[model samples]
Every structure is written in C-alpha cells, then in structure tokens.
Target: MSDEHPEPDGRTRHYGDFYGLSEPAGEGDVTLVIGNCQAESLRIFLDGGGLRTVRTPPIHELVEADLPHLQRWLARTRLLVAQPIRDGYHGMPLGTAELAAVLPGGGRLVRVPVIRFAGLYPAHVIVRPPSDPSLVPPLVEYHDIRTIAEAAGQPLAEDALTPDLVRRVAELSLSELRRREVANDTVVASDLFAAPSFDQMRTLNHPGNPVFAALAARVRERAGVPAFTVDPGRPVLVSVHAPRERAVLDAWSLDGEPTDHWVVGGAPIDSEEVRRAHLAWYAAHPDAVAAALARHADTLRLWRAITG
Candidate 1:
C-alpha cells in the first residue's frame, strides 16, 4: 500500500501507484495478470510487454484474458503479484466460478476462497505452486467477536473482555443495528399505505385523481415520502405522519390563511388549541395516525435496509 492521492474535496482518490515483483529464478515463467472492464487500456500494456493477449468471449470473460497465463504461472512461478484496477477491488476474492476458468486442467478448486489485497481484478491469487494445494494456507474470513462470545455463552462486559472479543462484539452490534433498521423501514412503508387518505385517493380518483393534491404537495415538502391524493372529496383528510406544522395544516384547513381552524371555515385556532385539535384528529383516525408513524419510521428503516 502507498499514500493515496487527494481529490478536490480533500477525500482520497481511488487511483494510486502499485508494484509487482517476479522471483529471480522463475522470472522466465512468470506472467503478470491484469484486467479491466475498459479492456482497451490493458491492451496497450499487454502489447508493450510483448505478452500475447487473449480475450475470452464476452459471456466467458470474468478474470479477463489472464486465466490461461495465470494457470501456467501458478504451476511454475514462485511469486505471483498483481496490481488490479481501482474500481474492481470489491470482487477481488476468487469464487468457484472464476476458479473453474483459471485453475489448471483437472485441478480441484478450493471451496473457501482466499482474500488478498494484491490488486487482482475480480479474483484474488491463490498460491500453491511448489507446495501441494492441500498444504496451502487456510482462507481468511472475518467474523465479529460478539458472535464468538455469544456462541461460547460468555458475558461481553468489561469484567471478562478480551481486545479481540470487544472488537468483534462492536462489529456484530453495528451489523445487528443495521439489520433492525431495514426491518423497521418495511413496517413503516406498510403502515403508510394503510392510511385512509391513500385508500380514499385510490378509490375515488380513478387511479390518478388529484383531489388531495395539497396534501400530496405537503408530503413532498415536509414528509419527503411518496404519497398520492384522493378524489370524491369528504371530511376525511388522511395523510402520512408529518411534522407538527404540516400535520396541523393537513388535519384542518389552512385555507391560504395563517389562522388555524379545526373545521373548513372556522375562526383561527390558537397554538394550544391546534395541538389539541391535531391530537383529537389523530385519535379519531387511528389508522391514519398509524400510517403517518409508519411513514416516518420507514425512512430510517429503508436506509438501513439498503446499506446493510
């Protein structure tokens, strides 16, 4: 690893310098593997090296044209090093699919894939040339310490903690929290859709009614959630849960006036009265309130779900 280049935003850029080395004795048999989704750039280097480049068919390309060379090198070469393109790092671990193409004829690919940061695009190197494949090092897999502690039926408090265990527990806790957030989002979305306004809009508007357009606009502004309006107007003003201001406005008519009114055309209601009215409205419309709560909860949940 080397110092990363700085981007305009003071964040480190992905591009960086990388180097590889071949064993002095096995230099003649060595073949450096390189690949890229944009294959033209790699072709220039391959031509420069005077090494023959073989492009596998589009459907067959994964490790690029380096599979055959990799197989040959693994058989004879003592050291294998690669500097893969930056964007492809996530898929570095070699899977069975890639191994099926790269391993020598009749070679039994390992079930557990090896993890290496040696810059191999889409597939990591597995070194087992001189040594028997069975003698090769065990594949590395990361696990949080909390899992181990829970499995051992041991307490995770400081009184009996190890550094590894502490770190692992922290990792596991974060992962669990992320999972919970995802579940929360699903529950919220379901609740929002259950709102009376949503149902009213669906039944009245022939699919695209804009009667509750004001509520929809408010939702877009304050709630930042997806919602539709209803037609065949009635006293029902169902809306997903929103901020206090938006909720009050939707529950009772703002009517383009600053005054708060509980009904369609009543005198301005005070802040305290507005609060009471909002509560009463929500109480009366339990389904609508639940939908609003779900709508808010879903935002947090959906984010966790995607990230986790």
Candidate 2:
C-alpha cells in the first residue's frame, strides 16, 4: 500500500537522497532498480550521485499485488537495473529480462551481481527469535545478539564472536535503532522497518563493499547513461560462512531431497526412540557416518564440476 501524499493518488512515494521526504519525478524519467531491501541502499547511492531511482517491491509483492502505480512506474522507467529476485523461499514470478520485455519503452536492462556474505544471524533469526529459553533475553536492552547473549548470562565463545557476526547483529541493531529513533507516538508499522539505517551498513549490498559500486558502474557504462559518480568508500570487512562443501557435509549426512538449507536425506529418526537408536547405532558404527560424509563430498565435487 502507498502512502497518502500531496502527489497523485496512485503514485508510490519516491524514497532516496533527501531524508524526511522525496518528490516523484517528471513523467518517464525514473530509473527503476528491481530488487529488495538492498535496492534501497542502491537508491540512496544513485540519488546521491544524481539519479532518480526507485526500488520495486519484493518479487512476491509485485507478482501478487499488480498495483496500478507499479505498472505505471514500469511503463515509464528509463532504465531497469536488477538483482536476482529473492524473497524468502519462493522463486520469483519473473526476472528483469522478462519484465523488461513487457514494459512499453523496452528500457535498458542492467543486471548486477549480488554478493552475499554469511550474516551472523540466519534469516530465521529475524523472522522468529530463538525459542530456546537460554537464548532469549529477559530484557532487550540492546538489540545486538552479543548483548542479548550476555544479558542471557551465556556470553558467546571467543571463536564464535566474529566481525561478520557483529556486523550482522549491527544490521539488526540499526533496525532496532530506527525503532527508537522515530517518534513512537505517530510511527507507522511500515516506517518502523521501511528504510535501513545507512550508518552501520550502507546498502544491502553493503554500500562501502567493493561489489556495490562495481555493479552500479557497470549499469551506468553499459546503459550509456550519464550520471554523477562518487566514491563508494571502503568495504566493511566481515567473515563469510556460506554453505560450502566441507561445511555442508560436516553438518549433514548424505541421505533425502537436498534443500538450500537442509540435508533431508540423512538417517530418518521420525520419533525420539528412532533418534536414540540412530545415535546409538552411530556410536557403535562411526564409520557409517564417515562413509555418508564421503558420499556428500563426492556429491559436492560433481556439483562444482557441473556448475563451474
């Protein structure tokens, strides 16, 4: 849903550059960046460099809602910059190329590479806080996970505490900070989590990160469009813990359907008794687990070869 403003009834609010408020562009002049929350940072960067950019809603929203304003924006877009459509688990209805094919002007489409860092916190952590009593804090004095852990009287191990983890927590902390920064009396739920705090992290792309600017420049150069340019500054270095061969196999056995996050084929333990039996069996026959791991490694090697 769009906000009620002085502009036309159906137009979505243009958000970037100037804080507090933004005005819509003249007809057919907007640059539409097709992405999610990360696109906001790109919008900010583009606006700062003198480009009128607006982020399309998450892929799910666009495909489901079919909002009038969105259609209008798409029709009028001068340039379409896109990242892979990722909203939760479901695949996107269409990508930038397919979407551009339908737009009236057939705008220039620039696809950018998305560099994902292993967030200290998982996606589920944001959607659902830990259910374990030991993890939940009595009071959320600070929104950072480390602070919460300390508050819960279970400080994280030194090895577990990392810059990536801290930054990931900081990303959420920025959201929490915004929650407090805004006036509580008149704050709307949309505004509460709408824009990300650029202080801790610049863009979902991690603005200062090397990848953000590289992609932006590629869009500008390939599109042959003139826009002001500025240094993206330094990258915020953080450790990445993405799913890889070694890590994946170590955590799971080669056994059911392999989802992005889970290895379903492992030994089935439908009940507590089954689980206990499996554990006992593993203890007695440790080589079985090792053999399963070897199979997982083989699977990964084949995957890498095929994909690469």
Q: Candidate 2 on 91-191: residue-level lDDT in tens?
A: 54366556667566556666553432222122112111223222221111012222223333444453453333333433544454345435322112222
Position 131, candidate 2: lDDT: 33
Q: After superposition, how far is residue 42 of candidate 1 from its true place, in Å?
A: 27
lDDT of each: 0.27, 0.40
Worst 10 residues of 2 by lDDT: 119-128
Over the stretch 12-43, how does candidate 1's per-residue lDDT look in tens digits?
A: 12111111122222112232333322222222
Residue 49 CA displacement from its true place in model 1, Å: 32
Task: Flag regions of model 2 displaced more than 4 Å.
Answer: 1-28, 48-50, 60-63, 86-94, 118-211, 230-308
- Model 2, global lDDT: 0.40
> Quick one: best lDDT, which candidate?
2
lDDT (C-alpha) at residue 293 in model 1: 34
The local distance difference test score of model 1 is 0.27
For residue 91, give model 2's deviation from the true position in Å: 8.7
